[model samples]
Target: MTGGTSDARDRLIEGTRQLLWDRGYVGTSPTAIWKAAGVGQGSMYHHFDGKPDLVLAAEERAASEMQDQVRRILSGEGPAYDRIAAYLLKERDALRGCPIGRLAADPEIAGDATLREPVRETFVVLHECLVAAIEEGKAGGEFRDDLDAAGISYALSAVIQGGYTLARAEGSVVPFDRAVQGALELLRLATHEGR
Candidate 1:
């Protein structure tokens, strides 16, 4: 019974994550969530306070997963720049859009501090990871001394989050690919090839 209960809770969170990604918080109704989770209506209340509470769980799950992915690539075996490059070039469902980024545009999520905190936290982690990698690169002479780590980190972040919008707008990944490649090329220009 405990195992079944745990499974139901997990399923609800996973289903809610998918629905939230497909439909914004306002659009993802409790009916739809329970239906997607293959659980009875009471199951949601059994595991969560309500939609808001459940949405928080899903957002945290998605945020943690994205952060972990970024951390792994950023801390991986390679130069700091290479790690950043690997992150940029990492295969993703561009047309579907960024999992955490897409939520930023939702008014319902944005207005609610409790709901928006996970998204904010996710970006914070992403920014920190980029900043750390760039700072390391500068210290090791992999990047130019004239560059600003914080500035570059934010710009690179914009390239990704904005790239998702551009890709979704056109229903193609070319724009996204171009954006990442362009960002990588620009970063390369800031590198010390011979120095």
Candidate 2:
């Protein structure tokens, strides 16, 4: 069927994504990817050049998906702080950590410019969206005009990434929730001051 080849390729990509998230780049073996994908060796080879090439494809897919989510929340209708709050409170697999952030920390992926491109872009896009939301909030009279969009964006992003690390380390989501609450409390102060 026409769907067979496409399905095999999709399976391989999905498998690679899962493996990369579960085991980092160095630990994710090509054999494991193919086996998890339920595809033959020939099929795997047919779809990707090699591990590096396949990994690149998988990273790109993950980056795109993450950026999509960031945009949806940051660009959503509401007050700027509300949008940011929605993102900070967004549901995620806290124990698993951020998939893209995990890749960014992996030496193999971090060291390779080609492989790191998507990871970098995902963060860049998140930064841009957060900045936009902050600016929008200012314009809507929801935040103080003196607030620095870039600084706030960086802090928020750091809180999120760091929250993941803390959550995984403690084997609990409390740290992540606390981090978000801290950020939200500060943002709320800005909101009231703006009024």
Candidate 3:
């Protein structure tokens, strides 16, 4: 019974996360969440106050998953530039927009600071992690000494977000690949100039 309860709660959060990502906050309903989770209305409400409560929990889970993925990608044995490039080009099934970025764009989410806090914090953590890696690379002479680690971190992140947007907008992965390729080319140019 205890195990079952935990399973149900996990299902509810996972379901909410998927639904919220596929369809923004406004489109996802408590009914849809309950259905997707294979839980009854009573079960969902017992675990969460409502959609907002559940949404916040879901966002946190998503953020944690992304952080874990980043750590794994960044910690691997390789040249820093290679690791960074690997992270950028890592294979994913499809362009299912960044969950946190999607939430950030929702007006309802943006209006509520409490709701937006996790999304903002997630990006901050990601940026800091990337910047630290870049700084390490600079120290090792792998990256340009004059590189602005902070700006580059944000720029790399922005390119990713923009790639998703372009892919979704143009209904193809071409734009996404082009965006990443362009960024990679710039890095190559900088490295050559640095040497």
* Top candidate by TM-score: 1
Candidate 1 lDDT (Cα, whole model)?
Answer: 0.93
- Runs in model 1 lying further than 4 Å from the true structure: none
- Name the best candidate (by lDDT): 1
User: Which lDDT values do the candidates have, in the order given?
Assistant: 0.93, 0.92, 0.84
Cα miss at 174, model 1 (Å)?
0.5
Error of 2 at 175 (Å): 0.8
- Candidate 1: clashing pairs of residues: none
The clash number for model 3 is 0
* TM-score of each model, paired residue for residue: 0.97, 0.96, 0.94
- Can you give the lDDT of residue 50 in candidate 2? 90
Candidate 1 lDDT over residue span 1-34, tens digit each: 6999999999999999999998989888999999
Q: Over 4 Å off in model 3, which ranges?
A: 192-195
Q: In candidate 3, which residue pairs get closer than 3 Å at backbone N, Cα or C atoms, i.e. clash?
A: none
lDDT of 3: 0.84
